[model samples]
Target: MINYRPKVFDEASKSHASKKLYAILLAFIVVMGIILILESIIPAIVSTKPMLEEMNENGYLENPDNFNFQESMKLAMKVSSSPSAMIPTLLSTIFGTVTAIFYCRCIEMRPVRSMGARKEGFFSHYITGIITGIILMSAITLLSVALGVNKIEICHGVNYKVIALYLLGFIVQGMSEEFIFRGYLMTTIGGAGYHTGIAVMISAVAFALAHAANPGFGVVPFINLTLFGVFAALHVVVFDNIWGICAIHSIWNFTQGNFYGISVSGSNNTESVFRTTAVSDKAFLTGGEFGIEGSIFTTLILSIGIASSIYLIYKRQQLQQKKQPSQE
Candidate 1:
């Protein structure tokens, strides 16, 4: 059975702010932080320690002292093989986002959007999302180059299936994120009496902070992700639908994992990325070995993508306005 929650009535198009909403959001942040910390620790306690000891005994990891923390951390992220990771990842995507949004709703109170006949087409969602991705990736890539940071490298023998899964994860993650941050969070805060700009800015910043635990998450990544959040909001403005944003995100990520063959947010998987060539070693230019999305080439590509998406939206809006019959 579905649980329904009704928001309080407000005469204005905007709704009243609820103290409860902010409280719930705060708690969500705290819990999420705790979980990330625990995940980091558990790997060392169980798998990492055991593997290192075995390696020491067998000489595979010959030098215990020389055991590179970064390399071990990479293995730790791969705690479970590709197939197994899906279970927890899916659960987290569904349960985590739902739980957070529900809690937020509890404070603000509202109905979930109708699950009835869907309004938007999948292609619209996918294409818009791809445009967003291209813009973002290209932007970071170019910025890195301008700043003397080239973070790209070509690799052979990519893992396609694993890449698919990774991209799927991004889709799930991106959709859930957009819903919570843009849909729920944006409405909650905006209705609660905050300016639209404030609400959007806060939500974007929050979204970036949420990923503070990712592998290559740094100032650059954080700023990039925040920009991503803003870009997502713009998507909502243009389409008033989630379809495009989700599609673009999924494709963008898949392209990275399958075509580029690098760690998505710093975690490796069983996937074959066709392109494997580093542009440089500077973090500023090449994302400093973090990922190509942070490279100069990606930056240039993103700039074009962003302009294209915007132009499409504007053109679409004008056409729709023109198509409307004149009222007598």
Candidate 2:
């Protein structure tokens, strides 16, 4: 059974955070602004050199009139694959975590633990989360391969160094997102006297919409993203801490992109351990440009996860009630 500690909400209630939707909206703006500024800094500084080199090779720089949009896009994709170019993009996500923490601690006057940064049981929770993430992502990839939705082949001469860099980046990237969405936004909303249900749903939808601009994002992908957000939120509430979900998010992305060689959320392919090549023509099964995260198998796994989380929450609630004496 899961532990249902409502410490976040209880603390939020005592704080002077904005009421209802304002907390969410304000938090959204602040977090987004901070993240955008931080994410742009390194990329803008370092990525320009690669782009210039690509442009020079393609003669786009020498002859501005002959600039080809298609070729430029390909150049961008190629540059994005370079570890030196992309690692900074991933690492910059730390600002998201910092931004959320700052807003909560300073702006809202809430303690860090109230944002689900509880120090107790962090290691065990994080390890369990890592295993759970691997299992979940592996299930999607293996099922796709077994059913002929996709095929996998060993990526020879794989750059383990590059993949390690990606792992580091994903650690920050995933934790940043969870801290912003689940820790800050969701908790803030719930702390403002709103129903936890409302807080969860709103944060989940916001998370989905945040990715609407990704390539190959469609109706089904939107649904899946929202479901993922819900699953992450439930995990947060069930465990009453962000460490597990943070690890899960990091492992999920790392396993998808670097371990199984699948595209991560419509992003371009990077160095991976195994290359998952598409064999089927069906976009629904193989997820087209969105990668395995958009596949039907993902839907199934996330649904099971959500159901399990709900069951755990219910069981925890029952256990909590039993622990309390009757109020007759």
Best by lDDT: 2
Give the clash count for each candidate.
40, 0
Candidate 1, poorest ten consecutive residues by summed lDDT: 2-11
lDDT of 1: 0.54
Tens digits of per-residue lDDT for model 2 on 139-253? Answer: 9999999998899999999989889999999999999999988998888887877776777888899889888877789988888899999999999888888999999999999
Winning model by TM-score: 2
Runs of candidate 1 exceeding 4 Å displacement: 1-75, 78-91, 104-107, 114-123, 127-160, 296-328
Candidate 2 — worst ten consecutive residues by lDDT sum?
Answer: 1-10
Instruction: Give TM per candidate.
Output: 0.66, 0.94
Tens digits of per-residue lDDT for model 1 on 1-328? 1111112111111423343557636754664554455343433344545455545664656566755677666554655334445424532565445654554445434544411002547675577568766555545444554555434455566545665566666776666666666666554555555554565567778877876766677877766666666666555545555567666666666566565454455555335444444555566455544566444455455445546646656676567667776742
